[model samples]
Target: MVEKKFTIESSQGLHARPASVLVNHVTNFEGDVMVHYNGQSINLKSIMGIMGLAISQGAEIKVTAEGEKEEEIMESLEDVLKEQELVKN
Candidate 1:
């Protein structure tokens, strides 16, 4: 598995739209992916699971992925989230 810790920069954090975006991204892959927030972990491919976390701005989250191609997926997901949040590389 690969993991990355990042802060949610969006004012609304991972809400409906962002959550759906994240879920869609993860679902596009063949491996398993999850996002950990506030000590709770949720499947990255499931919007409902992510929404349950109710993340907010400044919240720290750990993104992880496992299975074949997990390393690539985890790195890409981290980059995507940073892009979505307008974070610098």
Candidate 2:
């Protein structure tokens, strides 16, 4: 498993658009992906789960991946998150 802690960069937090971008990235991997926020962890590929977090700007989140290609997936996710200005890990 691989995990990276990120501080949410978007002022609006993990809203719809950004959540979709995250979900999209997660779906590309065949491994288990999760986002840890606050004290809870949820499936990264689930839009509803992500939105339910209601993460705010500057909130710290941990993106984790396990199983095959976990490292690559996590790296790609980090890139996209940075590109989207969503989270700085």
Candidate 3:
């Protein structure tokens, strides 16, 4: 398993757009990916689960992935998150 933390930088936080992006991104991986927030962890690939988190600006989240190509998925996720300006530097 691989885990990494990220600070949300989007002014709107993890709203529809960002959440959708995250959901779509996670779907590409063949691993189990979860997002931890507010002491709860949810399936990152589930749009409902992610949107339910209601992540706000500056909120911190930890993403963990286990199973096939976990490392590559994490790295790609990092890149996509950065490109979306959703993950703080």
Against the true structure, what is each candidate's TM-score?
Answer: 0.88, 0.94, 0.94
The C-alpha RMSD in Å for every predicted model, in order, reads 1.5, 1.2, 1.0
Q: Global lDDT of each model?
A: 0.80, 0.89, 0.90
**What's model 3's lDDT at 38?**
97
| Model 3 residue 70 distance off true place after TM-score fit, in angstroms | 0.6
- lDDT by residue (tens digit), candidate 1, 1-89: 88878878788777787677777777889977988887888888888888899888888888888899998898778777776772336
Residue pairs with backbone overlap in model 2: none
- Report clashes for each candidate as comma-separated counts: 0, 0, 0
lDDT of 2 by residue, 1-89 (tens): 99989898889987899789889878988989999999999999899999999999989999889989998998898888888888654
In candidate 3, where is summed lDDT lowest over 10 consecutive residues?
80-89
Weakest 10 consecutive residues of candidate 2 by summed lDDT: 80-89
Runs of candidate 1 with Cα error greater than 4 angstroms are 86-88
* Cand. 3 TM to true fold: 0.94
